[model samples]
Target: MNIRKVLTAVLPVALLCLAATARAATIGVILPESYPSADQAKELQLGMTLALKTWPGDAAPKLVIKDSGCDARKADAISQEFIKAKVDVVLGNWCEINAGADALRAAGIPFISSNAERVKAQDLQLQMGRIELNAGEKIAADLRRQTGLRISARTSCWMDFDAALSERVDAVLCPVLTMDRGRWDQVANTYGAAFRKPFTASSARGYAAMEVALNYLRRAKAMKPAAALKETQATATLLGPVPAADAPAPTTALQLVFAPHLPKLNAQQTQTLDKLVKTKGCACPGGTLRNGCPRDSGPWGELPFVVRGGGTPAACAKAINILEL
Candidate 1:
């Protein structure tokens, strides 16, 4: 065997492989430091890392993580750092992404947000990509047009009963988190094992953002990164299939009814409740008010509320309004 010749040939190939690995796409992730709690930020980071590990690729992209502290100035600084690093893509929560959006757009680096909040008009003009769970604004607009339900307040908190079920409001529009129970349980178990804590919606969101970034990179090999991202079809992610650019956003937001708001009914009132539940369908899967809400111990559980489902938000609003009246 020619040992010298073998070493010469193998060393070059090894160096080339290293070079290829080094050239893999760099992904920048900005997470909150103060507003949402440091533990949540850590969970988001862990979710991103897990996504990279599970990604079906020989060379995983590198990650450059920064803490925005939910501060605009800090977020802007982090964006500058990402720009200097020449990251192929960026992902972050709403605060950080919105604060640094202008700089990132100017840099021509594609960025995506996992925020479920309604996107601002300016952000839309900037062409910021978002994978959000809440479409409360859209739903509100739709309900307003269809049912003439007066919306008094909008909140992101799922358990904001005070605001959501206020006496002045006809209906509360809020985003709901939906996932395949089996798939979610599997992810939760794995995540809990790795982090020794319960998996959260934030964790799922972080994972989804990374998946989208990697997908964009994959498509960027053939076309422009922005176009690639824009063209990305619905992806079957941990949270579920993210809707394509033009596809109707998933049904995530629901109209909630404050159970306590309904006056104590006589036989006729009870009959009306039964008829409403039968025709409109109960928001609480536990059946109707007659059966009682089985799972009401969480946030809104403090006040006892029912979700209005199985019909349009406007219809739900009308029914609840009639019941209250």
Candidate 2:
């Protein structure tokens, strides 16, 4: 073969191969820069980074990160940018995803979120599907049934732990996400070592979102991306699975109970206290003090704070007045 003829053929083939090798999926990430705190955003990014390191593919997806600033307009703008860039998928926290839902859907790009608010009628109108780990409404409904109380689901992205401590809320219901304690511990240890901080629920959610995105890409090879995600079964993750629409709601919830410190009582005093609690009746919405007073439901001063003098109804009545004073 002539030198020029052979060289031309080899170079074109090599270039094609190189181009194929360089081509990788693009994943757009929208994270808050300041709204929830810079530390939280960093934690989420670190979790995604950890997942990328464990990617089974020869070539990992390219990450295009944008600061959403937890603003709806900013998130929408970022979504438009991702659409222009032709990203295969988008991963975001609670603050940014809902704001960008329409744009991402129009672009035919899948979106995965770590948290979600109670689904509304408007949310149902969106064509693109969302894979959310924290389903607040479902969790709240389950808690209501279990506790026989009015449980309100959080509608905002801000932290609610402080609200739980306030006088206005009776109790805060938290869901236990980790299905495998052993696996969670392993991941948490690795995350701690890398970030120099304890692994948080947000971090776990971020890692799980990436895992789900990768799973979607794998399934997309055989089917459309939307269909693949829709057909995605319960994937074992640090936070259990991406709940199927028809899946049963979680039966358990962790309720953070708040109550005033009670005086230590002896065996006789304890027996007397129980009797008094049942007879006196708790002023809270839950009906009785057997489960402790939910101060949010009624005045704390109405609670029988002193059972010291005697377990009689009159003694409890007098104690209540003293507490009020």
Candidate 3:
């Protein structure tokens, strides 16, 4: 071959090699706790992995997953590692990432999250794309409408909101936490309490959202300001009933749902309770004697539930919308 021609071919090959090396992508994943009920963070990992499996390239992006403990401190640590590793993309789960979400944004990295807990709206990394589960709220709403159950200010703590449940359920669908004592629920249902285990989950869309985030990164091609904006928009608009939708700005924050174990008093129970109310002068001031007034031991072995709004089966389905960010 001519000397000039050989040099030209060699330069092209060298440039191609450099380009290939530079294009290698890196993906990091962060998850919250994984115990009973829904582990959205784990679901995110599974979704991302499934998508990575289908990627058609000899140099697939590095996939790294870390736990966030559903705690702000833990999320900060995981985010720090991701920063040091210089990951091209990240997807975090639950509310844990809220703490480090700002740092990531300052670093100009993009991330997708599945928790609706209130967080700084200005941060760019904190993209509220995937919802964890809106079905819980919907179920609560539907239950209220259909059952016409009289709700109490207190909600079931079996799915405690402060720790395990969300704090947005409305009247007749109060928030519950796991911290509630077992005796409480037992006491609540000594009679025909007709209690329903408030339902929540890692949910069906858990994995799919992660896949969406990964696919978004692959398609973005560049991480410039404009491209990041586009990705942010895409992530902000994720659709589904599970994980719920992000609360729109200026929109009232979703209200909490609280209902009694015996939300709807059986008709016979109501009539019996009502007679007791009238005979015992339930409306009377101070304590009245059981024989002549309202008493715990009634015709049936039932005690009036100690709660706000006592036993009025007023429908409360029409409550503020709860959008899970």
Candidate 4:
């Protein structure tokens, strides 16, 4: 073992280590584990991991996953860890996003949400899945065709699967991710094999969101939060185009329409609803009534309203109206 032999081997090992470190990047993921629907968090992470496998390099982006528990406090704590480690990007479920959005924003970290309704355009908050929020009109139209009802005003059904509610309402619209039929079937098979359980729709969004995030990472010159956000919004994903940065929030309201005889609200309930409507003022876009449940009240009649099940049409049909607020 002479000095010359030792130097040659040490130099090669050092060069390899340097190259590996230079090419590697870190991505922080916040998922809700040990909380409601913990399995969803696991499934989502699996999807993200599977997508990362397709990255075009040997030096894959290193992932640091933290359990957010769907709580603001937990999410913030996990985000602090991400900040300390200087992660290149952060992605999470909507609950995690809602919990940690403020902290991540203040830290200048871009947060991509896999499932959530877009609340106005925030600089660091990017919504990725099923961004459309208002499906009231579409639900009503669907109801009309199915029940042959002259229904106009849209009422929200808390429990969409109830057969009784379905019989009464012209249609009950539930907000859900519309999966790509072909890819979903494939993913389902993969997920079943990987998890030893059935695949959920939320799992699909998790997979899609990660795929989109990776695409953005690949295209960006510098993986800074602002640059990533700009590039992602400007481009389209395999699923489709991301929403325009300047586009107004989605107006898709889920609704359950009733037949000709609208359900009547009790005196106290009616008063409460009326007050709620007054408080949520603008039933139209750009209105002053900030607290009111905005309603089309016009031919569209596609306002956002909620209906609860009861003994009869009166109890079952009663609804309270409001917007994202």
Best by lDDT: 1
After superposition on all C-alphas, the RMSD of every candidate to the true structure, in Å, is 9.1, 10.2, 15.4, 10.4
Worst 10 residues of 4 by lDDT: 155-164
**How many residue pairs collide in each prediction?**
2, 0, 26, 17
Candidate 1, residue 200: Cα displacement in angstroms equals: 1.7
Model 2, 1-325: lDDT tens digits are 6999999889999999989756888889888867777877777788888888877875788888999888889988988999998888888644644778777777788877554432332221211123223554554465344433344545222331222433444333343343467878999998888778888766776787788877777776678876777755456666666655533333222222222333344565444334433243332323444344423332212321212233444444344332222
Decreasing lDDT order of the candidates: 1, 2, 4, 3
What is candidate 4's local distance difference test score?
Answer: 0.55
lDDT of 1: 0.59
State the weakest 10-residue window (summed lDDT) of model 1: 296-305
Q: Residue 301 in model 3: shift from native, Å?
A: 39
Give the TM-score ranking, best first: 2, 1, 4, 3
Provide the overall lDDT of each model, using Cα atoms, as 2-decimal numbers: 0.59, 0.57, 0.44, 0.55
Off by over 4 Å in 4: 1-21, 56-58, 129-173, 193-196, 221-224, 234-240, 249-325
Model 1, 1-325: lDDT tens digits are 9999999999999999988756888988778856657767777778787788878975899898888877778888888999999898888654443667789889888877665443443321122233233345554554345344454325434321223466666556554555667777887787888778778876776776787778778887888766676665445666666544433333223444433345444565455344433333334433324333323322222112235644543455455555455
**Candidate 3 positional error at 222, Å:** 4.3
For residue 316, model 1's alpha carbon misses the true position, in angstroms, by 8.6
lDDT of 4 by residue, 1-325 (tens): 6999999989999999988657666778887767656666676777777667755654678888888766768887888888888776788754543566777788887777754445456787667644344344554565455334444433322111121234545334444344467767776787787768777655665677776667566654356657777777754543345666546434332323233333454555444433323322223333332233333232323344333332322333243222111
